[model samples]
Target chain A: MQYIWINGNSDQGVSPDNRALAFGDGLFETMRLSGDCISHDQLHLHRLMDGCRRLNIPFSQATAESDFKLALAVVESSAHKFWRLKYIVSRGATDTGYFCDNTVVPERIMLLEPFTRDVVSLQQHGVSVIPCRWRLSHQPALAGMKHLNRLDQVMARQEWSSSDIFEGLTADSEGNWIEGTMSNLFVVDKTGCVITPRLDNCGVAGVMRHVVMNTLCPKLGLLVEEKNISTFESADEIFLTNSLIGIVPVTRLADKTYKIGQITRGLQRALNTKESGL
Target chain B: MQYIWINGNSDQGVSPDNRALAFGDGLFETMRLSGDCISHDQLHLHRLMDGCRRLNIPFSQATAESDFKLALAVVESSAHKFWRLKYIVSRGATDTGYFCDNTVVPERIMLLEPFTRDVVSLQQHGVSVIPCRWRLSHQPALAGMKHLNRLDQVMARQEWSSSDIFEGLTADSEGNWIEGTMSNLFVVDKTGCVITPRLDNCGVAGVMRHVVMNTLCPKLGLLVEEKNISTFESADEIFLTNSLIGIVPVTRLADKTYKIGQITRGLQRALNTKESGL
Candidate 1:
C-alpha cells in the first residue's frame, strides 16, 4: 500500500497539525480505476473541485490532475488490472484554531491500491436491503457534497450484521427514503418513471447518480423525478447505484420483497453501455 | 509552533496511513489551560475516554495522562500567559480500505498552542451569532459524543461573514435548537428556571454545560430542564457556555434582545466560583 503526500504540488512528509486530522475539515474522492486510468475522471474531478470551492480550500486543477496521473503511474507499475484511487485535500497548518488557517494550503494525497472486486459485488440473486435505523441529517450546506465527516455512514453501516444484506436504505429526519450509506438509491414507480430522493437537504449526489441524471435518463427518455421517496411504504422496485457497483437490485426490504424489475435491469444495461463507450 | 508525534509513548515519525485522517473515525478533546494545567482536565479526559468507548477506540488512561502532562509541559515552558490544548485519538493505521484494515489500537496525539487572555476575553462583550441555514440531522447513535467528523460545524461556521459574529446556533432537522457551532445554549424561562435543549439526537454535551447543570443549578436551587426548545421566541434570556468562554450572554437574536437576566448572571458567578476553586 504505497502513498504520496503532496502539499499543493510539492511532495513532503506528513505533518502533525493537519486540520483534516484535527477537526475533520476536509474533502475526499475515491475513484475506480481501469487499465490504470480512472473511469469518469472528469465527473469525479468536477465534484472534488466543487467541494473544495465550497469549503474554501485552495485547489489547483492542474496539480490535482498531475498528482492523480502520477498515482495511476504507481498503480500501473504494480500491474494491477483494477484499483482504487483516493484523493484527500486537507486544511494544513494554521494559526492553531478551529477557524480557517490560511497559512497552510490544502494538502493533496493520492493513493492507489488493488481494488477488491470480490468484496463488493452486484448480487447475482439480487441484494437484500433494509430500512436502516439511522436517518440522514438534513444539512443543505453539506449535502450533495462528499466531505470527510462521515460518522453518519459509519454508524449506518454498523447497523447491518449480515453480509447477505448488500445495502440499507436510509431516510432523512422526515422519514422519507434518502439514499444508501455508500450508494445512491433509486426506485421505479408504477409508471416506469425512475425516482431518486432529492439531495438538496440531505444525502450525497453521487458521481454515478450525476451520470445517470445527466446521460442515461435523458438519453433513454425516461421520466426521472427527483422527489421524496418513502421506501418503507411506497417504493415499487428499489435499486442502488454507485461507481463501484454499477447497479444493484434490492430484493428483500423488511416484510416486502421486490423483483428484479425490467426497468432496473434496463438502466443497468444502459449504464454499462455508456461505460463501455457504446 | 512546536510539535511532536508519538506512537504509544515512543517518538515516531508519521505512519504510512492514519485511520483518523482516513475515515475521520476518531475522538478528540479541546481543553482550556489555566496556568500550566488544563481547566477541568479530568472531565475532558472522561469525555474522551467515553467517546473512545463508544467508538470502540481503545484508550489508555495512563498514556493519555502522560500525553496530556507532556502537552501542558510545553505550555508551562512558554512565556505566554494562556494556552489552548487539543488531544486526538485515532483508530491507528490500517493496511488500506475502509473495512478489513482492522487495526484496533487507537493512535493518540497531543498538541499545545500558547495564547493570550485577550483572545477569549473578547467574547465577554458578546459575539454576534446567527442561525445557520443548515440543520443538524438527528442520528442518536452518533449524537452527544464529540467525534472527529465535524464537517457540520465547518460548513456552519463558513456561513459567517467578517462582521465579527462570535458564533452561530444550529438546529436539528426537526427545528429543535441544538447548540451554538462550538458551544451549548441555555435560556432562562419566564419562571426563572434554566432550560437547555437536550442533546439526545445531535450536538456535543459540552463539559461546561454539564458543570452548570451539575454544580450551579443545584447550588442556586434553580430548576434545569433538558427539553426540546423550538426557537428564540421562547427564550426569555439566552446565554451560551463552553469551557473556553465561562459564560456568553446573548443580548440579541435576529432582532429580539434581552438584558443579561439576574438568574443568568447568578449562575455565571456561581460557576466561576467553582472554576476558580473559591
Candidate 2:
C-alpha cells in the first residue's frame, strides 16, 4: 500500500531504533476520514494531546494542525478520497535500554492511507460480541491514555479464531465490564439512561464514547454514569462505539440476544444527527 | 546511540508501520555483553524463543545468532568496550491495527552501547524500596512473556519523582509481589533459601533469574522456590536481578531493614563467575 511519513517532510522509511519500536514508547490515534477531512477532527486531536500530556510527551497543537493538513495532502496525492490517519510521537532512540540521557527529542510521524468504513456489515446488521476471558490490568496512571502497550488486547482478541465474532468485551482485573477490543461498550437500562464503563483506570476512553458522554447525555435527557458496570447478563440493551465506526449495535452475546432496542436506536440517530450536522 | 537491524538479508531501519509500534506486538531480550560475548547466550535465546512461541511470533535461532554477531560487530565498530544487547522481534507492518492479513515477518533490531550498571551506591549500601501502590493486572495468557506492553512498569517507575528512591516493588492484582521496575526481585529467608515470585500469570520470567535458579540452586544446593512472595517488610533479605545488572541488594523497606547478607553475596559471586566463564 501507499503511505506518507511526516518526519522528513517527504515519505521515507523509519529507523528500527525508534523508541516506539523498541519499548513501544508512543501514543497513536486511528481515525476515519471523509475525502480529506477527518470526522470529529478537533476532538480526536484533543484526546491525542491529552494522551501526550498524560505520558509526559509534549505536543504543539499548531504543529499538529499543520501536520494534519500535510497528512491530508499526502492522502489526496495518493488519489484516495477517504482513508485512515495514524499519528505517532516516539521518543527517538537513545543508547541501549529504556534509560535515555534525557537529551533526545521525540520523533513525530504521521501516515495517511486509504480506508473505507465497514459500512455494509455494520449498517445492514449489527455485530456480535463475546465477553472475553481476558481482564485488563489496572494502573490508574496509565489507564485511558491509549499508549502503545496493547498486547493485552491483542491476546484477548485472539481468544476466538472465528470470523463471525465481531468484537470481544474485556473486563478489569476486578471483573467489571470495561470495553471491547477496539471500541467502547455502552448499554442502555430499562429506565432509558445510558450506562458506560468508567475508564478512569483501565480501557481506552474512546473518542466516540467521550462524544456520547459529553454531548448526548444532557441533550437527550438521559443519565450517563461512568461507574463499575455489573454483569452483562443484567443489561437491557448493549452497543459499542469508536471513531472509525461511529456506533455499533451489539446484537448477541453467548446464548443471549439483543434486538436493536429503542434507546440504542435513539442514541444512534442522535450521533448521526451530530455527524451530519458537522 | 549505535544500532543494527537484521530482517531477512539486509540490515536497515524498521518499517514505519511495524506492529511493534502499533501494538507492542513483539518480544525483546536485554542481555549483558562483555568482551563481545553474551554471558549465558543459550539461556537468553531460550527465554526469547519461549516468549516468541507464547506470543505466536516466529523465532529463528540462526537469525538471532547472526544478529548477536552483528551486534558484536557494532560494538567493535564503537569506542565502548562493554555494552548491553537488545534483540527485538516485532511483526513488520503489512496491514493496519492489531490483526494482519497474515503473520508479518519479524523485524530484528540490535543496539549496543557502553553498558553502565546501576549506581554502586544502591548495590553496595542497599537501596530503599517502596511497596508500589499499583498492581499488575492478572493476565495469564500474556503473563511471564517479555511482550512489550509495559505500561505497568512505566507507571510503577513514575510513581516516585525523587532520585532518592532507587526502585519500586510491584504486585499482582492478587497482592503477591511480582517484581521491581526493571528487575526481578528475590528474597532470602533465615534458612538461606532464595525465594522469588512465580511468573505464572504475571511478571516477567527473567533470564538471569533463570540462570541463578538452575546453576545456583543445584550447584550450591540452595533451596530456591518460585512461590508467591509477600511485601518486603516481611522478608529477611531482598535483592533484584536482571540481565543488565546481575544482582542488586535491597536494604530498607518501610520499617524493615535487610543487611547485604552472605547469601546475596554468594549469588552475586556465582553470577559474576558465570559471566567471566562466558
Candidate 3:
C-alpha cells in the first residue's frame, strides 16, 4: 500500500466519507501482476464488474477494463516484476446515511505491493491448513461476490498466528464446508470427482475457481461440480486456489497427511500451461 | 465529511491500507453531539469497546474514552451545535493479506458532519416504513457488534428511494423480523409486552435499543424483552431507535396506519427525561 492510486492518481487518498470505509459497500479484485500482463485479467474484470452491479455501484466492465489497463500504465515505471495489484471499487464519498444518492461517483482504488508471502508457495510440494472455528454468515444476496465485507475471513485468519499453517478451512453458520481463509477450497473425493462448495450460500466466487471449473476441468475431461461438501476426511486429495497463488494443494489437515494425488498434479500442470499461455 | 480528524489531527486522511477500507475489519460509533455534549456517550463507548474486543483490535474503553473526549475537545471551537460524529476504529494500516501484525495500532478516525435529515423525525406524530426485500445473514459470531461490515444495511436501504419512507424493516435469512436499515425496532404486542428482535443472530444492537430496554422500560414499569418478531400487522405499536434520532415511533407499515399509543408516548417521555438528566 506504500504505492497507492485512487482513480489513477498518486498521493490523493480515498475520501473519508467513502462508502467502502463506512459500510464496506464495495467490491475488490486481487490479481497477480507479472511484469506487464495481468494473470486472469479478463476473469477478474468480469467478477469485479458483476460484484459492482450486485452491490448497485455504478460501474461497467468496459470502464473497469480501461481503468485496469490505465492502472497498469500508470505504474509502468515500477521495476518490480511481480506485484499484488488490489483494485477496489466503492460507492464513493457520500454524507448521507444508508440511502445513497444515485449520481454519486464510484471510487477506484489501486494498491500495488511487491509480491511477498510468509507462507511459502509450495504449489507442487503442497501446504497445510487447519479447520477454522470462525463461521461464515449465509447471505445468498451478498454471497459469491468478492465484496469488501470480509470480517469473517479476517476473523478466520486470526484464529492461528503460527506460520506453520498456510490457510484455514471455513464453514458457513449451518456447518456446511465453504472455503479457506484467503483461498477457494477444492476437495477430490475417492471417486476422483472434483468438488467445490456451492457459492450460492456464502463464499467468494474466486476467479481461479472459475478457471478450474470452466477452463481447466473441461481441458482435462474431468467432472467438476459444486455441492454441499461437509468433510475433508473422505477426500482422496485437497487443494486451494486464488489468482495470486495459482493452485495450492493441501498436503495436510490437522494431523492427517495427504499425498499430492495425480489429479492435483495434473490440474497443477494444466494451470501452469494455462498461465504460461496468458 | 466536510470536517474530519484522524486521531485528533485535522486535514489528514486515513492511509490507503486501513483495514476498514480493505476488509471492513473495524468498528464505528455514530454518536450525536449537541453543542459540547455527546448523547448516549457511555453506551456508545461501551459498545465500541466491546466491538473492538470482539474483533481483536487492540483498543480498550479507557483509551477510547480519552480519544472520544480528545476529539470533542479538539473540535471545541466549532460553531455547529448539532453534529453527527462518526468515530471509526480500524485495524489501522497494514500491507498484508487477511493476517495482521499484532503490533499495528488501531486507527481512530472521527468524522464530523452537520446533522441533516431528508425525512421528517416525526417523533410525536410517527413515521411510515416499508418492509425491505433484502435479508440479513445470521452470524452469531458477529451479532450485536457494530462492526464496519454493513453491506446488508446498504442493500436493505437501497430497496426504496421515496422520501415518504422513513426506514425499511429488515429480516434475517430465516424470515425473522430483525431491525430497520438504520435503527433497532421494537414492537408492542396486544398483551402490552414490548418485544425487540434479538440481536444474538444478526443485526446491530444499537445503543438506543439498549437504553430503551434497560432504562426507559424499567423506569416506566413496562415488560420489555427480546424475541423473534416476524410481522407488523399484529403489533399494537411499533418504534425504532438509534443514538442520533433517539426514539421514533412507527405509525404505519405500508398501508396499515397505527395510533401513537400511550406506551410509546410514555417511553419517549422517559427517554427525554433520561437524556435531560445526562
- Per-chain TM-score of candidate 2, chain B: 0.91
Best by DockQ: 3
What is the fnat of candidate 1? 0.46
Tens digits of lDDT, candidate 2, A1-278: 55667463765666766778777777888877765577888888888888878766655667677778876766666665567888887766655444544466777777777776565368347888888887887667678877888887876877776878888889987789999889999988787778999886689988889888988777788888887886875678888998877777889987689888877777777887776522
Model 2 segments more than 4 A misplaced: A75-81, A100-103, A160-162, A234-236, B8-12, B72-81, B114-135, B159-168, B173-176, B251-258
Model 3, stretches more than 4 Å misplaced? Answer: A74-79, A116-121, B74-79, B116-121
DockQ of each: 0.44, 0.51, 0.81
Ranked by TM-score, top first: 3, 2, 1
After TM-score superposition, the amount by which residue B163's alpha carbon in candidate 3 deviates from its true location, in angstroms, is: 0.9
**By descending lDDT, how would the candidates be arranged?**
3, 2, 1
Clashing pairs in 3: none
Q: Across the candidates, what are chain A's individual TM-scores?
A: 0.91, 0.92, 0.94
**Winner on lDDT (1 vs 2):** 2
| Docking quality (DockQ) of candidate 3 | 0.81
For residue B99, model 2's alpha carbon misses the true position, in angstroms, by 1.3
Q: Which docking band does candidate 3 fall into?
A: high
Angstrom error of the Cα, residue B177, model 2: value is 4.0
| Docking class of predicted structure 2 | medium
lDDT of 1 by residue, B1-278 (tens): 54564553535344536777766878888788766688888889899889878876666778788887777777777777666777778877765444422346778876666655463354355556788886776667678888888877876876775656778899987888889889999988888879999988889989889888888899999999998889666678888988877778887776666777788778877877776621
Query: How much is the lDDT of residue B4 in candidate 3?
Result: 79
